[model samples]
Target: METLHEIPALRARLADWRDNGLRIGLVPTMGNLHDGHLALVEAARARADRVVATVFVNPLQFGPHEDLDSYPRTLNDDARRLSRCGCHLLFAPSEAAMYPHGRDAHTVVEVPGLSAQLCGASRPGHFRGVTTVVAKLFNLVQPDLAVFGQKDYQQLMLIRRMAADLCMDIEILGLPTVREPDGLAMSSRNGYLTPAERARAPALFRTLQELAAWVAAGTPPAQAERDAAQALSVAGFEPDYLSVRRRADLAPAGPQDTALVVLAAAHLGRARLIDNLELDRIVAEAH
Candidate 1:
């Protein structure tokens, strides 16, 4: 696979591929790749003729007190993994190359209501950073399709919405969240978990699952959130938020729809973990 660090070089290679009738697929990541990221590449490869994975630890999305300074950047290992996955191109751009004059009069991309809730509430300008960087990557790569992990469900939804609203001529695909044997969602941030914290992390997923079961059994959404928050507290986590909302519009769950999602985020020591579970409509019937 060819590796290009500069945007122009990467765009030139992508142009050549387009001219040759090769369908381009792009996977944008913040480096520190794991199985979840590779899954995206595999999905991209399946959908298009050429796959390009861009690894830039974007600074725009990170808040002031966030882990941006310590965010893992395993470039060598990431490259090796992408190579094994048969990725055709890898674009790893520097912060300066990406921002040039540093976040100047750039047109910010924000998906109105969606960015103001859930992770949006906690991270402040997180989604703004996400949408802006993703827009930049889309413009730079110009792939026929882009693959994102469903683990960041809100982010994925916003990206899909942004692409559509902005008239981006590319398909946005969100693959399923990859998990560990113990049920913790696989994330690059998982690397920061201390040994003891890592062992306790799966409790987040367990709490989410238990709450989802309650919601499926006709429990009030508020009560379900309360119980999940308690479970997370009992598991030694500092509960950030535990909410049950209609998965379709991300609105609070109501009597009209049987399908719901139980989403939770918490502080397990210094690492902030997030997990969610979807309840199928048939789940209500079974209960």
Candidate 2:
């Protein structure tokens, strides 16, 4: 696979594929790839004739206090993984290429109400940064299909909402969150965990599972959320948020809401991890 840095060079290669009438797929990422990211490439390859994966560490998406500087970058290994996995092209652009006029000067794209809720509420302007850079990627690649992991369920939903509202025709596909032998969600941030913290990481997913059980057993959503947060705290985590919400739009889940997802974000030492469990609507509404 060819790795191109400049936008024009990347566009030129895509044009040749377009000329051949080949369908295109996209998988975007911040470098430091793992098996979970490779799964996204595999998902895209299954749906399209050629896959275009992008590794751009979006400055827009990182809050000032977030780990933008310390975030891992393994471009060489990332390219190797993509090539071995059958990716057609890899676009790894520099910060300047993505934001020639600088991040502060670039136009922002916000998705109104949904952009400021849930995960958005904690990380102020985080989803705004996400939507803007993703909108920019959509404009640049114009791929027929784009694949993302459901691990960041809110992000998957946000990008879908943004594309639909903006009327972009690309298909947004969400694959299941890949996990280790233990239930902890696979993330680049998982690298930050100390040995002891890593051993404790699985508790986050277990807590989310317990929360889902409580809601399924006719418990109030708010009560279950509080119980889950307390459990995480007792397990040695600084809880961020653990709430039940309608998976469709992430509005707080009502008593009888059919489509539901239980999501959690919490701090464990230096690493902040997020994970979720999508509920069976039939089970959640049974009571």
Candidate 3:
């Protein structure tokens, strides 16, 4: 229920909690709260004694042509929703607070290979912004655990890798992707969709599902990716990338790869939606 906007104040509160032996959890987000974001708060509440949810719309993660200025900011409503979801604190900082040195002069964090493909390929310097801001949050909150949604599978993977590579002691947990009844992955950007586009949006998830089925049934990975992209085109989406990659490092999937994920991102009307399914899990359930 308490909201702290400045880093020093938030860090002081977290320090007090740590001194009192309370376990802390962090759920980092850009505002425009929805069920999917609340799900992360709920997961944090279950795992830690106190939860801090951050609501700063990071400018670093957005490209020049992307909706940085128009990205939704519903802070008051987001605060009310997080409090109801049992969040203990909300750290909603201004852009200047996040980048005191200005974005151009700010230190950047890049996961190199991981940041060069899929969504990264399409949105240049996107993950650099993500990794840097997340690193800042991780440093500020210093939580025992942090929760992220699997709806952003690439983001989740890179954060985990960054924390490990940088020797951060915090645990990174990825909760399942929350979805609408029709299977469209719940996203803050979903608000950009018009009513007509919304109706056609579930096809993104359905396309990933079909791709998973194909990979599970022994279809060639490259062929399955091409066919899935084609199917999305027919479903009224301009496909970005529909890929099968090793779930571990997101390297392209080879014939013998068992642990794999089907990931897709595409343009639907004014919104870009992304979704993924783990093929290893699907293949296991076939027996």
Candidate 4:
């Protein structure tokens, strides 16, 4: 597999693939790949003739206090794994390659209301950074399709919105969240957890599972959210936002809404774990 570190080379290669009549798929990521990330590559290969995976630990997506400097970079190992998973090319661009004009002057792409709530409320300018960088990638590769994990449900939702709003003729495919046998959603940030914190981590998923039960049992989402936050505190977590929202637009789900999702984000030691569960599955399980 070829590894590229510049924009011109990436576009040149993509153009060659396009000329050869090969459909391309993109899987953008911040290295430290695990099974979940590899699963995205597998999904990409299934749908496109050539798969290009990028590893840019986007400084734009991180805040001043966030772990930008400390975020793990395992490009060599990541490339090996991606190649093993049938990825055709790996684009590992440097911060300068991505920012080009420096972050302050870089053009920003923000998705209005969707970028402001939930995780956005916790990390201001976070989604703006996400949308901006992703927009750049979409323009650079211009792949026929791109794949993302549903673990970052809100980010997935925002990306889907931005792509459509901008009319980028690319198909956005979201694969289901891959989890550990213990049920923890796989995240590169999960590496930050200490052994004991890791043991306690699954509680976040368990909490969402319980919240799904509450919603299925006719309990109001707001009430379930309040109770779940309290539960997280008892499980040794600094709760962020835990709520049930309409899956269609991520607005708060009212009683009449049958399609809903329970999403949660909380601090567990150094690792901030986020997870979600669909209400439809919960209702199905109940019956």
lDDT of each: 0.89, 0.93, 0.93, 0.93
> Which residue pairs in model 1 clash with each other?
none
> What lDDT does candidate 3 reach at residue 169?
99
The 10 consecutive residues of candidate 1 with the worst lDDT sum are 278-287
Give one digit per residue, the lDDT tens place, for model 4 in 227-274.
999999999999999999999999998777888899999999889899
Model 4 ranges off by over 4 Å: 281-287
Candidate 3 residue lDDT tens string, 1-287: 99999988998998899999999999999999999999999999999999999999899999989999999989999999998889999999999999999999999989988998999999999999999999999999898999999989999999999999999999999999999999989999999999999999999998899999988898888999999999999999999999999998899997777999999999998799999999783333434
Model 1 error, position 117 (Å): 0.4
**Per-residue lDDT over 1-287 for candidate 2, one digit per residue giving the tens place of the 0 to 100 score:** 99999999989988999999999999999989999999999999999999999999898988999999999999999999999999999999998999999989999999989878778999999999999999999999999999999999999999999999999999999999999999999999999999999999999999999999888887888999999999999999999899899987898997668779999999999899999998865543344
> Which ranges in model 2 have alpha carbons more than 4 Å from their true place?
281-287
Best by lDDT: 4
Question: RMSD per prediction, one decimal?
Answer: 2.2, 1.6, 2.5, 2.6
Which stretches in model 1 have alpha-carbon errors above 4 Å?
281-287
lDDT of 2 at 132: 96
Superposed Cα RMSD, model 1? 2.2
